[model samples]
Target: MKKFDVLTPIGLVVGVVMLIFGIVTNGGITGFFSFIDPASLLIVLGGVIAGLLINFPVKDMKHIFTVIKQGFSQNEQNLDQLIKTFVTLSERARREGLLALEVEIEKVKDPFIRKGVLLAVDGIEPDMINDIMSAEITAMEERHRKGRNILEKAGEYAPAWGMIGTLIGLVLMLKNLNDPSSLGPNMAVALLTTLYGTLFANLVCLPLASKLALKTDQEVFLKQIIIEGVIGVQAGQNPKLLEEKLSAFLSSKERQKAAELITSGEALNDEA
Candidate 1:
């Protein structure tokens, strides 16, 4: 919670820096302003935004709001800790009564995961647990899908917007056909907006959509492991078996750490 992590928008920062360097290295800074095209910028922005709203619903737009904010969010949602903690909780609940986990659940920062755990420990049947958790999963997926769609829509829109920008510039240029001296600068502004649009679509929006999609899949998988572990815990399996089962959620490095923890604990027990 203390101020840390990468909050700066890397895409915007890198773009600005490269633009500045290119301007200086090519023809100098004045050349940049000499070719500035406000109309081109407006076309790209307005067209993209209009296109996105056309493609997705208002609800989806709400999801996109969160995705946009997450672009600047610095907190790295670490899953390794969540896996380790949940497994430890499952094992503890087996050794002690389910009520023993009440305190731990209170401490969980993730409300949904914690709620699922509590529901299981309260002796909900496996089927009922699945129904509740599955509903939650469906809702989460819907929410996530909307955000991804918005980003994808933005990606699709950007290039078309660029083309539109170029067309508008070209039309104006052609209208002044006798002014050959005006053609080069007009074309540069026209083409630059297209370049900006295409690059933004391909290099930025598409990549972000892919990243968000991957993150959504990963989190869903993690929650799936949680669902299984919670159901397993509710059924009251052997704590060691429960630990082994939940360990599947962790990466290989985490799997190794879990193994060492179990081994060291066993060794201490043997010595005692």
Candidate 2:
């Protein structure tokens, strides 16, 4: 299951608010308007976009928004629930045989788990199943890397474009040296572009890219657990031993939590 990741939006809003607050505290609300340089914004934003277009293919560009969206959501990995599921599947397989798991597969939501279980049921060799599933994991990692590369490049482009905007403003200011009145506005444009670029890169692009990478790592970890569980089931390992093997993947804290959940579940079952 996926849930909205509040931290991304909250962090962005906090950064903006703090920036606005800093401006207001230093120069008041009216002074905040001085920072709004449309031309500077256009230069930084347009330059970044153009650089990305040149850097990546059109098909990849189309998925940029989708990649960003992934940063705002997270997969809810309940390790306890996942372990319990595999344990149940293991027991059923040991009791009723591998073919019986076909009915149980319908109750499994994750396509990866379903596919692995189905492969086992089909009597595929354990080595072949591991090879096939491992290949899928590799492909998934590659896709994530591609998506993350776009954001990483965007972060890199933002600051460079800001420098370009700064140089442009500087040239313009130098050209209008005689016009004392134009100097302040031109300077403001120059400084604001750098600010915008730095803020966009640090606060948005780089952060989101890092978050996506972390999420990808977490997902890969979960899938690895699934792979082990599937393989254990196919091998007809003792359910108790399989649970112990899978539980090894959890941290001490997670093991404690899983134990608590298992105890509670068993209590509920006894009561029923």
Angstrom error at residue 207, model 1:
2.4
| C-alpha RMSD of candidate 2 | 3.1
lDDT of 2 by residue, 145-201 (tens): 999999999999999999998998899899999999999988988899999999999
> Which residue runs of candidate 2 sit more than 4 Å off their true CA positions?
260-272
Q: What is the lDDT of candidate 2?
A: 0.89
Candidate 1 RMSD to the correct structure: 5.1
- Model 1 error, position 199 (Å): 2.8
In candidate 1, list every pair of residues with a backbone clash. none
Best model per lDDT: 2
Residue 158 miss distance in model 2 (angstroms): 0.4
Once model 1 is optimally superposed onto the true structure by TM-score, how far is the C-alpha of residue 255 displaced, in angstroms?
1.5
